[model samples]
Target: MTAIDIRDVSLEYGEGSGARLILSDISLTVRSGEFLSVIGPSGCGKTTLLRLIAGLVTPTRGAILCGDRKVDRPSRDRAIVFQDYGRALLPWRKIWSNVALPLEGGNIQGAALRERAIELLKVMRLEAVADHYPDQLSGGMQQRVQIARSLAQEPKIWLMDEPFGALDAITRQQLQDEVARLAAERNMTVVFITHDLEEAIYLGDRVVVLGAHPGRVVEEISVDLPKPRDQLTTREDPRFLAHRHHLFGLLQGH
Candidate 1:
């Protein structure tokens, strides 16, 4: 089943001569329970495309559909994890409170909400810091908290924008595995945006490469690597290397 459909979409800022065109006539489909990683150069509208799917921004033309519904605004079904974890979290709210914020509006309350928050924190390996504030945690831990909060929503589609960009190498790799595992276990549909080609290939079932200048799809490469991928073995596989070389070439205009 198709989880997302971007049909002949185009986005621009301003109007007439002063208008800046960002995305030009881009179209794509994302399948349910699929891991899709989008990569491109600095100004290739990767984040914008993600925002479009989230219904945080509307296209100048064309429409985006999430499942059978037309996407016009953000919904609980779609959750976004931004690269800047600092801004995403509420400084005054303790870890558990932050995670439970979304559930507060629903039927969940009191002990149940707290329990659910702690549960997601455990999934992110952050249960130990359930009482801590965002200011008390390290960059990586803060990101993990952010992830836990997003997961608490139990979103159908996960939209992540360079979420691991600020973490140390070790932490980045660890979270990459955690995200891949969680997504698979829940059968969640994920739209991951990152500038790192290797990271994209590692996590994605298919990698979508966008071209700059107009920010459109250049190529969509399928990653046939086995699930529950091994960092060492998967990266070393001949097919992995082939896909990497191809993406690098596309980005470099080779």
Candidate 2:
């Protein structure tokens, strides 16, 4: 079953002669519980593509459908985690409260909110810092909080834009494994955006590579590698390296 169906979508800015086309004729479908990594050179409108699916932006032509409904506006069903974890989290709010923000309304009440927030924080290994503020935590911890907060939203689809881009190599690798594990465990539909070829290959069930200048899908590859990916073993696998090399070539205009 398809969780998201993007059909011939195109997005343009302005009118008449000044119009700038950001995305062009992008048609892709993300299967339910599939982890899709989108990779391309900078300015390929990767973020714009995410925003369109989030319904934060609309296309100039064609349509985007999340299940049976058209993506016309923002909904809690699609939770987006941006690259800037610092701005994505609230400074004044305690870590637990920040995660609870999504559940503050919409029937969740009182102790239920705290219970849910703590539960998700525990999943992210962030239960230790549940009482600390966002500013008090390290960059990686803060990003974990942002992810936990998104989980609190109970979104049908998770949209992440270069979420681990800023973290140190070790932390990023840890988070990468964590996200892959959680998404598989939860059977979540995720569209992850990244610049790193290996990161895209490591975490994705399939990768969609885009070309720049009115960003469009240039190639899509099935990962085919075994699941429960190991940071060391998976990257060292022959199949993983091939996928990485191909993706690198595509991004490098080979």
Residue-level lDDT tens digits of model 1 in 59-119:
9999999989999999999999999999999999999999999899899887999999999
Query: Which RMSD values do the candidates have, in order?
Result: 0.7, 0.9
Per-candidate TM equals 0.99, 0.98
lDDT of 1 at 132: 92
Against the true structure, candidate 1 has what lDDT?
0.95
CA lDDT scores, all candidates in order = 0.95, 0.94
lDDT, model 1, position 200: 98
Model 1, position 159, has a per-residue lDDT of 97
Q: Model 2, 98-141: lDDT tens per residue?
A: 99999897688998888889999999999989999999999999
Supply the global lDDT for candidate 2. 0.94
Top model number, TM-score: 1
Query: lDDT winner among the candidates?
Result: 1
